[model samples]
Target chain A: MKNAKPSSRRNFLLTAGLGTAGVAAAVATATRGEKPRAAMPGATEGSGYRLSEHVQKYYKTTKV
Target chain B: MARMKFICDAERCIECNGCVTACKSEHEVPWGVNRRRLVTVNDGVPGERSISVSCMHCSDAPCMAVCPVDCFYKTDEGIVLHDKDLCIGCGYCFYACPFGAPQFPQAGAFGLRGKMDKCTYCSGGPEENHSAEEFRKYGRNRLAEGKLPACAEMCSTKALLAGDAEVITKIYKTRVVTRGKGEEIWGWSMAYGGSDKLSDLPGGKA
Candidate 1:
């Protein structure tokens, strides 16, 4: 009975290890195929601040 | 970090329509669909002024807000883009745009509306950058190529400036100060006069 428990535990560990390897391979393949966004010249040269509503309000104030 | 922007000095614009032509030619924009154009306030008048108009890429874009399909997305550079594949040709964006930037091309035997088209700030759409799919739907992705919008770069008078906002604003401010800003704008009154008093305009605590 003790030997049976040990074998089942080993089997569980083996299944878990294989499942993890399969997930890692899938992630690597997906990442390789996906094209990530590249930085633009403007973004590289200057502060790439998001143009939010507060900025628009500030721009309205500066309109001469 | 360049905050991409475009500013056209009315005093320098001669109504040449050069900017319009540049944008059209660069993108191969279809017939009857203009992504950029010159708006002259008082043509023929001595002190008349003109400004090139297009999508300003507003911080709070109404088109983005109103798109029922939720196709619009803003890039890190503040360029507004949309996925043509997701667009349903419902024309909600056309009505929502304050600049009249959204355009529709007539299609099919029934004359149905094609997908929505707009300036894109020359940054193209959500498609892979500079891909044929992007070009066929949204025209060129010049910004990704490290180039300014064709309209501003090709302006003959140097009136239309496009770059990081701070740089262009500085250039515009210097010109205005050095040249002695004019006291009277010929068509400003005609084009923008509704009421002199604030109370006359439609305003109340809804």
Candidate 2:
């Protein structure tokens, strides 16, 4: 019936809205549980401490 | 590579507060913040000792460990620095620090505390090296300028030595050997993870 088609369309929309919300909630939860990475300059991985050439030379000068 | 470190010779320190003044001037630190200070033990006593105190840039910093936002990071030279942008001014780092290094600006109204500030070991923050933004947030980047910390450099008695850990250790050992006493280095063991007594160092007992 024509009335049944309208009800089915509403049901489809409701299902799609719920699905979208479920995905959003899932993503939010994942983001909350994730550990935030440190904002380090010139570091790609790990805790940003690196012994570059300049530091190495400075060390040589500090030697007794 | 060498890990940055500081060694304050209590025997030589005159409690002049020169290190504190130098640090404040070099950084233009605000009124309420003292990045470096002199701690005197046994005040008014026969043999009181004064030691320059600041952020030790610990091998394993407690502030970094307890930061809820994970804003603290260590540089290649082992300087512990924090990002002011990420800091919440929660005073958690203040409680976690053993040296009392974390300082919050108290100029806000309604008892509001500002972002935590502390000694950066003459090394700037995550901003560009020597940039105005970096100086505004973290003070001078003397380390990046191929120089040592101002506090140590300005010590009149050369009581405060700052540089690579291995080198300073050697320098301290020589001093202990020459003086023939005062082997204890306050906060060295706690900060650097070793025996605080310089007698433990090689040639320190001589």
Candidate 3:
């Protein structure tokens, strides 16, 4: 009812760490048949872009 | 030159999952690849409401920014798309997306994550329109056909509206003013955070 109490920061950190490990495992499995590249971090920015008005409106509505 | 959007009116959503079915059927999205879903708050109570969610296709898309391989790109209509060829299955997009929009199929041996998949807003992918390759990679190109998204079209309660922002906002405004119960839900801060003056909140800038 209250949206699971907004998970604790510790829980979030644990989950993030576990998730990263899981993704790394998945990536390892994926590249088993192919050559593996060194892992890299995500990009910090993208080409300057914005959502259309239609997409913007989704977040504009009031919560029920 | 306006960007398209999808607005879900939580008060009106019935959680029939019609939108989910429509998306899966329209895209043949395969098992475990949920392009859309219903998130309900206050379940089984008077104030219980379900909101359909997918990729908001954010303006400063975290997925695009977080992709290690620069696989994502934006369409002229402001739809977010990605190239399967460039994807490394690292799952950074999944981690970065606020809406949990991106999904991956476990293909190859050892449960490897396959190409990232999500709602294309019915505009399809980077390939040429209506080609088999495009269909295989990105599903259908319904936008080029001048049709609305399958999810919105199939929404039994008309709760999910997808189209040009101006058009959908006008429709929502009319509904709100006519129904007279939407002022509190008119902006993101209030609906999601229970605060109308969201810009004043920590880490927020309206």
Candidate 4:
């Protein structure tokens, strides 16, 4: 009976280790290099505002 | 090893909004969201000048550091980017950014902030290049085409420049030294309060 108990405990530990590995593998597959979804599509595009030639010259001078 | 940067000439701005239009047309940017805008400090005055403002994409990006989910990242070229999927819409980046670069859309009726949005410097997001998924989430993938940003390309006066830091700085420096008086404006010291020499500015030293 003592020997039987040890075998059962060893089986349980092996199962737990495999379960942990399986969960980790599944998570890795799910999240491997997945791109995040955008909250607002095209939200960062420029609004249609133009700078005049004179203003352009000023921008050129001030750039770092 | 050098990161890219932007230097706007507040004095040269004409408020014509060419860069804004170019950006909109190139990316088909949706209404109510401005990737670039004109900010006039002194309106209706003799000294009034329109300054174009957008993501400054700082070196020590506060958005990247503050993100709880490690969503924000930087490109090899120094362009700051973030993963929209990982973002929790916490609004920490918006508060941390000095240039007010981060933006969020209202998702919940209670005005809860959604995922953050900001300029990508035309590089697109963390998806496969030019994929439909990338387009749906981020926008156009102009960097894949080996072209400069549309806003800079479409600048009627060539006011907005987007390129390698060294190249752009050389162009600006040539113009400044030639103009002499504009040197104060060309380097960051005069623009953002540093030294008069370009090498004196942070990241300005070679």
Candidate 5:
């Protein structure tokens, strides 16, 4: 019983460390974003080249 | 309005000259003039790299700065195009352009330098968008048709990318990080196509 409590505390600390690392890993993945999308605002106005079909094409092609 | 820009990933480029051919076919550029080109480094070596090159449409364009006739103009979309009608064929742009984007058509036996022509970012010139006059003088205004430059679109490996500066840079950054290696200077590679790769192509330089 004398060493039992200390080992249990150590085990708790290890689990907490692993949990923190898991949370950090999840946060990092979430921030990285799921799909790579670019901001090309006002891409359809003025010129004859509207974003219509080509924008779709770009989406499929520029995959990271 | 989205500011247009071009980016090429040298690591993926195989020096196929596909971009160069696509540009010529799109613009019908004269026999002697090339709006785009490819430069390779380390031919027949281990680290050979190739890149597509053309007008970068810089934020501070040297061509626009040096032109005496003020023919050069930057579009609302940040495309730097020139008015051939106003150009004096002075060749100042050829010298001023860091990428050698300015090109002259050798139209005569006397080595005559015709009107200065360069990559318009496929946005045409000062003329009305999608106009016939615009096509004859500046080639097709694909941008007016809501498209990126043909060279970028036609790139085989998708090494060349064209679109808004923010978008392309973001995409390129994503690729550099995802691929996890090979440093990329996107615009610089296309602008200069650095000559330091170790080529491994068969039968020497292709």
Candidate 6:
């Protein structure tokens, strides 16, 4: 067998492809089981009282 | 940090009672208690109008003023919530309310009046948020879930708008400006009277 390395173009493409897959996998793991982000600012789940995400949704619907 | 409020556009309401259903389902409210209701003016007439009615959560709530046991309290967001544990079921709040928001469920077979219940603006009562007892006593803590009141959200026609007073007022104003008419918000004058001095009217109070 030839003792030669792969072409630089192939090596760069392989590295880029692996790097993107690794980043996407990390993101998916980090976000797993976490609650969705609130649509409105300053709204937190399990609160006494705060402006809520539903307000944002309502605003969208009421757009005139 | 915004003061919560509800504004129902009478012109858009179809009297479908979807809001009532949503409220009931969300809270699993017991029988004979309605936290929200519909009121139609000039029913069966050409100029008929339907408006969803509930606790307006007034800035200076009359219910708070009249509660004998002092169970009523106002949140930072201006929501008027009462403690069922402390409520005496005297019905004074019910009588004092302009919209008749307070409701007393029949507790016993003889129709005994139970503790008062009303709209919490979907913020729930003083109980722990998202707890089973809280859900049982009040309704779903939609506010805690970063959601608005079910009745307003479920309104198919977007008639009922609930959120920060400024935001909803802006939405309503845009609709009014676009329509070029119906500038008179249905319950705004009654629930929250304007700054028009009585002396300025045709009849002089001064």
Winning model by TM-score: 6
Candidate 5 residue-wise lDDT, A1-64, digit = tens: 8999999999999999999999999998785543222224545366634456775587469763
Residue by residue across A1-26, what tens digits does model 1's lDDT show?
Answer: 86999999999999999999999999
TM-score for the first chain of model 1? 0.54
Residues A1-63 of candidate 3 have per-residue lDDT tens digits of 465556576689899999999999999877554411211123112222234343344334421
Model 4 stretches with alpha carbons more than 4 Å out: A1-64, B184-206
Instruction: Give a tens-digit lDDT track for model 3, residues B77-146.
Output: 7788899888888889999998999999876677589888999887778776655666777887666544
| TM-score for each model | 0.66, 0.70, 0.68, 0.67, 0.72, 0.74
Give the Å shift of residue B94 in candidate 3: 0.4
Tens-place lDDT per residue, model 6, B9-92, is: 998999999999999988888989999999999999998999999999998999999888999998888898989999888889
User: How displaced is residue B68 in candidate 2, in Å?
Assistant: 0.7
Question: Residue B28 deviation, candidate 2, in Å?
Answer: 0.6
lDDT of 6 at A35: 34
Docking class of 3: incorrect
Per-residue CA lDDT of model 4 for B79-132, tens digit only, reads 898889998888898898888878776656665877787777777889776555
Q: DockQ, per-model, please? A: 0.04, 0.03, 0.01, 0.02, 0.16, 0.21
Query: Largest DockQ belongs to which candidate?
Result: 6
For residues B177-197, write the lDDT of model 2, one tens digit per residue.
Answer: 577655455765654455766
List candidate 1 segments past 4 Å from native.
Answer: A1-64, B107-111, B182-206
> What value does DockQ give for candidate 3?
0.01
Summing lDDT over every window of 10 consecutive residues in candidate 5 chain B, give the lowest-scoring window. Answer: B196-205
- Model 5, span B1-206: residue lDDT tens: 66778888898898999999999998888897899999888888999888888998898999899999999887787888888899888888889888998999866666568899889888878876655577778987777666778898888788998887756765665565556454344453454333322132121222
RMSD of each: 13.3, 12.7, 21.2, 14.0, 25.4, 13.8
| Order of candidate numbers by DockQ, starting with the best | 6, 5, 1, 2, 4, 3
